[model samples]
Target: MSTISSASSSTTTASRPTARNLGPKPQDNRIPVTPAVLRGIFASSRTPLEERSISRVAFFRFTGFLLSCLGIAWAAARGRGIKNSAALLGVV
Candidate 1:
């Protein structure tokens, strides 16, 4: 039982890959950008036309920004109300 467990553990550890085992990473070429490249990058062929089937990341980011704006507005309103209440109590 002990030998079997040791063998299984060794096999599992050996099967796992190290960073050096993987080859070098690919480098991006962002130094020289022309007008054409900029247009291609911004308006690629894969650009979604329909609003309902847009990229998930873009959708989430937009939603997060909208929610943040709403939260800021709510906090500002609440803070103003608190200040008014405090001022009224102080006057009384």
Candidate 2:
């Protein structure tokens, strides 16, 4: 039993030095940016003028759809007086 316990303790002590050396040691400050990475980031940052025009059209279409939906919901709720008059009815 004493020999087994000593062997296990020695193995544990041997691993501590290797575990401490396995981590980053403050000298790994290198940027790995290639041309492909730079081009990808640049292309995604700003759209071209033609693409901007298409995006503007899509934006207005989506805005109009959203406004129409909001108007329908507002008119329906106003007709029912559920959202506004519920507070007065003590159901809120």
Candidate 3:
């Protein structure tokens, strides 16, 4: 291969993903327009009661995430491994 050469084999060997090759940083996914953040986003424009109302997208997404986590936990408790639990969840 281009990366593995005969000269290198005659001297020192190279291993991939070395110390300096740590992958990209994990992304902290903060929702830009979630229901909870609405109060802060529209604090000046809207009344407190109006800002308290939740966004439909945010509500569904939060509920879905919560339910999916609960289902995975339940499946794991039943002795199903991650792969199997994920497959079972796909069917559900």
**Number of the predicted model whose lDDT against the real structure is largest:** 2
1 or 2, which is superior by lDDT? 2
lDDT of 1 by residue, 1-92 (tens): 99999999999999999987987556554477799788667666564663235567688999999999978866876776755545534563
Clashes of each: 0, 0, 0
Any residue pairs clashing in model 3, and if so which?
none
> In candidate 2, which residue ranges exceed 4 Å CA deviation?
1-47, 83-91
List RMSD in Å for every model shown: 10.5, 7.1, 14.5
What is the C-alpha lDDT profile of model 3 across 1-92, one tens digit per residue? Answer: 85568767755645545677786666646556778587566676877665556465678889999999998778675775445555656754
Q: Give candidate 1 misplaced runs (Cα > 4 Å).
A: 1-54, 82-92
TM-score, cand. 3: 0.32
Q: Is candidate 1 or candidate 3 better by lDDT?
A: 1
- Candidate 3: segments with Cα more than 4 A from true spot: 1-54, 80-92
Candidate 3 overall lDDT versus native: 0.69
Model 1 has an lDDT value of 0.74
Best by TM-score: 2
Candidate 3 C-alpha error for residue 41, in Å:
4.2
Q: lDDT by residue for model 2 over 1-92, one digit each (tens)?
A: 99999999999988776654787766687668899889767768777985678779999999999999988877777777766756535678
TM-score of candidate 1 relative to the true fold = 0.33
